[model samples]
Target: MTKKRIFLLLFSACFVFLFYRIYYHPETRARENHDRTRIVTDMKGRAFQVADPIRRIALLGGPTGQVAFILGVQDHLCAVTNTLKMSKLVQEMYPAIKALPGPRTTSGNINIEELINSNPDIAIAGDIDGQIVLDKTRIPVAFLEDGMGEGMEDIKREIRFYGTIFQAPDRAEKYVAFLERVMHLIEQRTRDIPVQKRKNVFQGFSPSHLVTLGGDTFMQERIKLSGCENAAETVTTIGKRTGLHSGLAEVSMEQVLEWDPDILVINYGKPADLYKDPQWRNIRAVRNKQIYSQPAGVFIFNRPTAESAVIFPLWLAAIAYPDLFENISINGIVKTFYREIFDFDLTDLQVHDILLGTYEFKMMKGIKNRG
Candidate 1:
């Protein structure tokens, strides 16, 4: 047989062997028992080894820094990129981070001298590029993938992974429990909505083009949980295979008019507003006063990663079925989030602007006194 044929046969044999080992073997039973004792996840979302980690800290990206600050372990950060700015949410919670020192990571050229200067025990950035950068620095780098588009459960597992690495599994367990409690309640309430009533929602891309997230995107999952149906989430499977998802489909305005969305919930700020033009005024959503603007808050759209997932669902739900979930408190969730995860207090003022699309934006100013 040719090499391709030979390789295919080997792969088939391995798959069969692995399947047999998983389903029928006595040893598999023993391994599963151990897995149950510890938190574990595999590359394919399978429960596998419980991650055990110990560390010094290095962060390579802005979002990683964002998450660390949210976790109340900003002190654990040994290094980060200098370009980092505090998000409206982070500043709302902790304004003291302006003084921290971080090194920026670039791909084209390596900064050997600067790398030598920041003596970090571990490099905790979100990608293999971080590892490559750390490798040049000759430091032990732990590459944490920035799972911005991952589902709620996946985000939780990564948080748990961080806790595992930091030897703070209890903290991870605490986060998991809090997430589960809120999610369980939301799921139960929305279980009654029939298929037809689910809102046909359309997401906005960064203003350069008409690209938007499909149900495959992370934020779309939030849209569904929040009681709205994504118009485009069903159209593409682009985000799943490749972790780096961007450059959405170029759709025409005419197509959007055909969809006749009940509400136009754009993830981007005023710039992504499709209904801004005179031609769009005739659109049903615009005519019905349903065109809504989403200002960038704690993080950007669909970045339902880690702590964002906590607030994301609530924010989406509130927007989708405000009447059904008017009583549900984002402030209460914020308090629980800070108390349980960050061990801090979030003011109602922070919660107000956060949902109002004014917390953190480049152009618009937010109301400081939310109450």
Candidate 2:
């Protein structure tokens, strides 16, 4: 054969070999890895053997889904709860998330049929209902504790838990380090502020403005961590009963008027509603326009999420004590958070829109704007 023909044949053979190694080799290795299983202990202290790679996941809670998204394992999410589907942040950040199938219930109850049909390798649920899931689909269900008593630590653990589950322990560790750094910074900045000087904050949840968080809730810890005292701390009804009732409770308007918080933080109501209301006008927060709506990101900042564990304290501290944190750049913190955690490159406008909750996405239906 001619030397030219021999050279061309060698070149074609090399090209074909490279393509096979690049495409088929990795896929074959992935299949081999997927078949491997390992035993893991979930937050509920239950042990189960899960796929090594955990290629598909079903999230039973919105916050859990946010955690997965933050850990950069969202590509593995096969199914999510309806609440996550309704989240404005999720809609904006991952438009494709809406196309995924969701369970039937809105009350944290997973639909067995939908979950089975989705065919996730494992499932992460908010509550410890593993038997129900196991009985139905034979899928190992890992329970993630809702952030309540431990505050920031709980969120960090949740992040690390999922990180381990999805084989992204390095990413989880990085985020935990970021969380600890921010927490330490806030602590150092506000540590010396005396109890008497801390801002008294009232976190209103419902339209009635009567349902507020108690001291034991995550929001209360967030407030305290931000160098502010919860105004509703005096309310004895909250956290009195067991279960979820302890986190939130109803209070009368007279009781709130008595508390007379220095700052009002509403999770679901417009600023105009408080500013224009006759009863609220006399309150210190309303009179001074100190009422600030909690910013909603992947999950509501007022609520618990890994993102909120870091971001909420910074945002609240800046608002509560501006002079002390004047040197801290909240905008920079937010920009870095989105870039690192969500892997989304946000422009200045996008960052502002998230902070202000005015990104022009559809507001969660039936939920009033707290801004």
Candidate 3:
């Protein structure tokens, strides 16, 4: 009885060892790791399966191409939308992108044949464009959040998502930390300002002086971060669409006179235009000559992008309350951020031009307003 039991136990042990050696060997584990696919859930809550080490990408959405550049994955881009190409600031930073193929227009029109020829490993896009690309091509598509919502978390969320997709989490975390530092600096400086004393800001968008951003867009985030109030905060998102001018709404001249913001940061006409125009003479911003042109960098701060999320609030704070930020050197900050994060060296004159919004004016010259 004892011999029989011992022999059976030994046989069972041998079978267990053989099974472990076959399935859990080092070489087998390595092969599984190499071939394993990852599932990523986009902001829209759709799940997508992506293969490891994505080598080729097609950016088919707004504000994402610039983010790819931020993540240091711009070299892997095989196709992009026309929005990036249309941005004069982007052209200055990454001139090589001019040669890249734009298979999708910013308006969500896709040229399937052109996109197929590009043969990207993955397509990162907005909901509509992403679905269209998924339907038309065999390539995997990852959707992104279209609007930036009410605060800073959404911006960070998008960046981290891109980091995962690009396999550059370290780089993305580094950028996020840097962004938080800048944001904290702005908050510390402006936190002490009394709510009653904070200035009221109105953002006048492009194409028409009366066209402005409402409280629903990222523009409100910029104003609030700068320790100021958005005079247009009461404007509803009744007619908002999902595109370049998503949360923008047109207000009547009577409305401007009613709000009478203390400062007007515009993307269109100059301060002088407001002062001379009889229709705007009674507004507090015009009466006090507190009009300022909004700065434009890789893209206009009309919407949120990685660059805007990091830099726009700081810039706006400096403009809204120069006395509070007297000790901080915004010029140096802008120069360092562009040089270090963007890998683009900015001259002192270039920094000055950007701060004063002259750079935007120069780039926009002769180009009809797109809004």
Among these predictions, the greatest lDDT belongs to 3
Q: For model 2, how does the per-residue alpha-carbon lDDT over 186-285 read when each residue is reduced to its tens digit?
A: 8999999988888888877667877776766777778888899988776544445433333578888887888888888776667778899998887898
Q: Model 1, range 1-371, lDDT digits (tens) per residue?
A: 89999999999999999998666453333334332333444233434333133223556655456556545466666555543333556555556545544455332223545544544545565555465664565554455656545787777767776665566667778778888887776787677888898767666554532556666567677777777777776566443333334424546677677777777765455633555667667766677776565534555444555666667666666666777777777678767777677766667766566555665453123222321
Query: lDDT of candidate 1?
Result: 0.59
Give the alpha-carbon lDDT of every model: 0.59, 0.75, 0.78
Candidate 1 lowest-lDDT run of ten: 362-371
Off by over 4 Å in 2: 1-34, 128-131, 236-246, 358-363, 366-371
Model 3 stretches with alpha carbons more than 4 Å out: 1-37, 148-150, 358-371
Q: Residue 286, candidate 1: how far off, in angstroms? A: 1.7
Model 3 Cα lDDT, one tens digit per residue, 171-268: 78877888889989999999999999999988877656877877877778778988999999888653465565676778887888888899988887
What ranges in model 1 sit over 4 Å off? 1-56, 82-84, 105-115, 147-149, 237-250, 267-276, 295-297, 362-371
- Candidate ranking under lDDT, highest first, comes to 3, 2, 1
